[model samples]
Each structure stands twice: as C-alpha cells, then as structure tokens.
Target: MSSTTNYILGVFDDEDEVLHAVSEVKSKGIKIDEVYTPFPIHGLDTAIGHERTRLPIAAFMFGTLGMICALSLISYTMVFDWPMIIGGKDFFALPNWIPVTFEGTVLFTAFGLVITFCISNNLFPGNNVEPLDLRITDDKFVMAINLDKNKLGQDEITKALKSSGAIEVNVK
Candidate 1:
C-alpha cells in the first residue's frame, strides 16, 4: 500500500520574507510543516515555534559513557590484569591515560551524534529522497504546510502566503 501526503508550498525569494511569512501564517492559525532555505537563517527556528534541540545533552551522555569505558579498560588492564610499571609511574596513572580517554570521548560523541541525526531524520541508505522544491537548495526559501494538519482551506492559505510576500504558492 502507498500513501500520499498533500502539502502547500509557499516559495519566497528572500529569507526575510519567509521569516515574516512564518509569523503571518501562524497568526492566521495555519500550522507550518517546515521551512527550507538555501542556507541557515538566524531566528528561523524560533519564528517557526520549534523548541531547542536536545542533541547537546545526547552528546554529553555519549562522551561520559566513552570516558567510563576508556577508564574501565585502562584500569582493568594496568591495575588488575597486567599491573604495568613503566617510567616509575603508578600502575594506574591519570596523566598517562589522558590521551586515550580524550580520544575515546571524542570518537563516541562523533559517532553517536551522526547515528542519532541520521536516524532522527530517516536518512537511512536506500530511503527515497523527496525535495519539495528544487530551488530550496539554491536561491529560494520555502514554507511547507501539510494540508492534513491545517484547518484552513487552500485558498485562505494561498491568500495568507501572498500577503506575506510569497512569490509563488504551489500545492503538491
């Protein structure tokens, strides 16, 4: 079985116009699905009412786990299993363990964040890619509104887009 989702796309030539349109559309009670731009626009996320991401928290957790694993391995090998005594240093010297610990923390955080981002965005291998508007990756700013999520009719939404400086409004 296949399912098709309908969307109303408001294409803007400028980032400022799209930013203003986000507020205008929301004021009229039309929920915006997402906004796409050629580059990042400051305050766009806030304007679109998206909450702050929790990726930093995830990174911290991953780093901590990595540090623990690194420390555990070093402690087990040097202090318990082998009991190494090199350069007159203690078997479990903190100074010597810094490099490995730092590397482990960085490695886990990098890999964890990449996996998290890919999974969150449904960007697995072989997943079909859908672009609402090709210009969104070049020069245009696009505001996408999922028709099923909005109570407003297409005509009303189109009017709202025009009043907010959209150059073209398309439905797909």
Candidate 2:
C-alpha cells in the first residue's frame, strides 16, 4: 500500500523563538516530528522531550569488545604461537603487551563508534535524503510536525505555530 505523508513546518529566525514555540506547541497537545536547526541549542533536546541517548553505553560495549580481542590476539601470538622471550622477560609479558593492546582498543572504539552512529541515524554514503528547508542548515530553525501523526487539524496547528512566534508556516 502506498500512503502519502504530510508535514507542517514552522520556520523561526531565532533559536529562542523556536525553543518557545516547541513548548507552546506541545502545551496544545501536538506531536512534533522533528526540529532542524543551524547549530546545536542548549537544552533543546529536553525541551523537545527527547530521552537521553544510549551512545555512551554503546561506546563502552564496543570498547570492551576491542580490549578482549586485543588481549586474545596478544596472548595467542606471544604465548602460544611464537613464544617470544624478549628482553629476558617471560613469553606472556604484560608490560610489552600494553602498547599494542592500547592501540587496538583505541582503533576498534573509534571505528565502532563511527559505524554505530551512521547506522543509528540512517546515514549511509550516497544516500539522497532531501532537506526540509535549505535555510535550516544555514540560519533558520524549523519545527516539523507530521500532519498524519497528530489528531489536531492543520488550521489549529498552523494557528498554534503562528501564535508561538513562527515567522512562517509551510506545508509539505
């Protein structure tokens, strides 16, 4: 089945106005699909009712995996496979393994985080997603409301946006 989705965009020139508009619109029991801004705004996530992200947890898990892999490789190569006795030390030398293990952990963590972020955000190379508004990337702050997701009529939503200092409202 093919279905069309409609979006109502509220454009604001100032960050403060957009922030205020978020609260004003939410107070009227409207659901916002997403907000686009030129730069990060402090406390905007909380204002928009977004939950805390679990990226830190994902980072820790990836780091742990890296550490395990590094340790395993060092143990196998140095202790079991080659049995190297460098600097008159034992085959399983902990001190010598420090540098390689650290490097491996850093490398894996860096790559893992990049892959995780890209996958989570659906950002892939050559993906041609259209922007809601070109000015949103430069100077404008846009609050997009999915018309199909909310029970309120378009006229009411538009009125709420206009009342909340929106410079312009457009439907797409």
Q: Write one digit per residue (lDDT tens) for candidate 1, span 1-172.
A: 0138889899999888888889988999999999999999999999998999989999999999999999999999999999978999999798899999999999999999999999988889999886988888999999999988888899999999999999999988
The deviation in Å at residue 62 for candidate 2 is 0.9
Please, what is the TM-score per model?
0.95, 0.95
Which ten contiguous residues of candidate 2 have the minimum total lDDT? 1-10
Cand. 2 TM to true fold: 0.95
Model 1: worst 10 consecutive residues (lDDT sum): 1-10
Q: What is the per-residue lDDT of model 2 for residues 22-140, given as tens digits with 9 covering 90 to 100?
A: 99999999999889999999989999989999888888888888889999999998899989778899997888888988888888889999999999998999977788788999999
Return model 1's CA RMSD, one decimal.
1.7
Residue 12, candidate 1: Cα error in Å is 0.2
Question: Which runs of model 2 end up more than 4 angstroms from their true locations?
Answer: 1-3
